[model samples]
Target: MARWESGAVEPDMATQAAMATIFHVPAERLSALLWPNWLPMGELFHVEGVWSPENCHSLLDASGDLMLERRGFVTLAAGSAAVLVREWQSVGRAVPEFLSGTSEDIALGFEGRLPWLRDLEDAHGGGRVRRFVDLELQYANELLRQTGHGGAGGRRLFRVVADLCRIAGWASADTGHLAAAERYFVLGLRAARAGGDRLSGANLLKCMTLLLAEAGRPQDALLLARSAVDATADGPPRVRAMLTVRQARVHAILGERDACERLLGQAETAMAETDGQPCPDWALYFDDAEYAAQVAACHLALGNYAVSDHLLERTTRLQPASRQRDGVTYGLWWAENAFRLGEPERAAAHLSETVPLIESGFSTRNRTRFAQVRRLLHPHRTLPQVRDLDARAASLLAWGA
Candidate 1:
């Protein structure tokens, strides 16, 4: 054990299996995952406790320690993820206890800064904005500790903290801190529940679903997506549409074409039902362009490369100029699809176009995706276009480093 902890020796498969048994992890999961990847490191899946302000505070405190741990990405096992979602759904709705306090103005102040922070993240990328986001989260935590969860102000404060958690989680995920992201999401969900903000809670679940899907846990992602949809049965039409599209993306990943198309159609129908009624501030980002991009992603997952490419072009053009990170992301996706479509030259050209944008910004997620594309193009490295792309990508990687 000492040798394993010091990295001098790894636990053999038998030792790992025994450790898994002690940790309550399933044997099959241990076999499926690499050595330490099977270990359950966070309390996100520990659904044994009751949902309350105290529990939320405890989680928030633990999350601060989690932020300092730079361990690599680790996702919940499919069974564990399913259990977590079920526990989340079964927890009683917590209402903020009203006490003598005046924090409404303070909560509003935090709320006002959210849009600017979000814009910075979207424009510059998560690596640039993550520290700022983490600072905001810490501030929110301080407020929670000082204010004592009660009063109308307390409820509003919880909502603000939940928003901060969502942003922090997203930034962490973008910067390749997946463990921190998952913890933040769980804490945010608890905060949202404490504040009775169903919409925000649903959003957190949606974010978690996407995160799991990106981590190659589509089955777990699908479960969470379904739970989000069910929980938001009476939510705004646009929000419902957004969640449905996300579920469709997971279905596409799982190669369930018919289910994916059916969900996509449902999402479109929900969008048509939206009469521009004021949606939640968070849901407003799922506009026409965003919707098209999500649909394109679903198609990409389903292997409809040509259709995905067409929609991606439109999506990129429709994106706001300030959303440079998003533009670069879509451009990368386009390149991946091109490669999948057997057009290495086109793929190389697309990848070359994104290099300048990537060098100018900072997104670990985008950089990771860029690496994936480079690997895809490696076999044709001798080609002229591929050679040019290699040179450009090499410089971008050095800049990132």
Candidate 2:
């Protein structure tokens, strides 16, 4: 056929072109011959290593409106070459509300990826940040890749990665893995930096400060919290409030009531100006229950058992397990309050309850706080359960049991 023919068309060429495009097949280009002598459908999910274009064409294609979305699970999506999976299913299987089911349909043959993603998270965290180091690295790697792409989507992903890193760090600190928590905190800082969010970085630093405070290094925690506060002062009201509250927590740990109270007042002032000021992303975790609970801990540490008791009871009742049961801090709060109220039996009981959750298990942050409370109980270390718990707390008991 000539390139330009007057009122003449080649039916053979037109049919060949239409067939090639219709079935996603390679056509008569020189490069097509150099395509490694391999089939064009080498990337098929289940039916690879065979010429299956005819079979592929037999399968029904989705319409323009046919769509499937992954609400939270990114792991399953990445398992397939496509980031988004379309809706296509078979009979006799239970309809899954989440993206956790296996893909058995011929058109969608890839299985779920959420389990692998969760495995990666667990390997780093061993179920939480305090128990796993291997999984933390992998989780951070995944987040780093996701946040590398610039734009609103990148920022959104960066925020998620940042939150996960912070969670891991917090869990690490709670489980007594201070160094691992610190590493997570650093990665969280990097994630925040990727999104150019100073407030998020400040929040990560706040987490780090809490870790230090939990390690019985209130001075260090106070310093870190102060640095975060100073850096984020002009950024957002909520960010500033969170830093100040953390600083107050450090001071409270140090038994510096006056300084702690001042910081608490600052936090309140920041919170009171909610009319026009914007809340930084970091402070979203802060609320009335949190403030009250933290302040109660401060009082408990400072020997104000009555005030601490009131606060602990209120906070505990305020947020039930249906809402959040992983609050090792709340457990510590109740235990300390019981200890400070001259209730050795109750204190020991609370310790017994909180110990398994904090000492033998997760939360180095909780351990350190428990240790502090244990120190407070040192005056009565000779008591029965206290004697048993003193060993668990690793307190200053030099003599024989």
Provide TM-scores for the models. 0.85, 0.54
Candidate no. 1 TM-score: 0.85
lDDT of 2 by residue, 47-70 (tens): 111112222112212111111210
Q: List ranges where model 1 is wrong by over 4 Å.
A: 1-45, 75-78, 91-105, 397-401
The count of residue-pair clashes in candidate 1 stands at 3
lDDT of each model, Cα atoms only? 0.79, 0.51
RMSD of 2: 22.5
Q: What's the distance in Å from true for residue 24, model 1?
A: 24
Highest-TM-score candidate: 1
Clashes of each: 3, 10
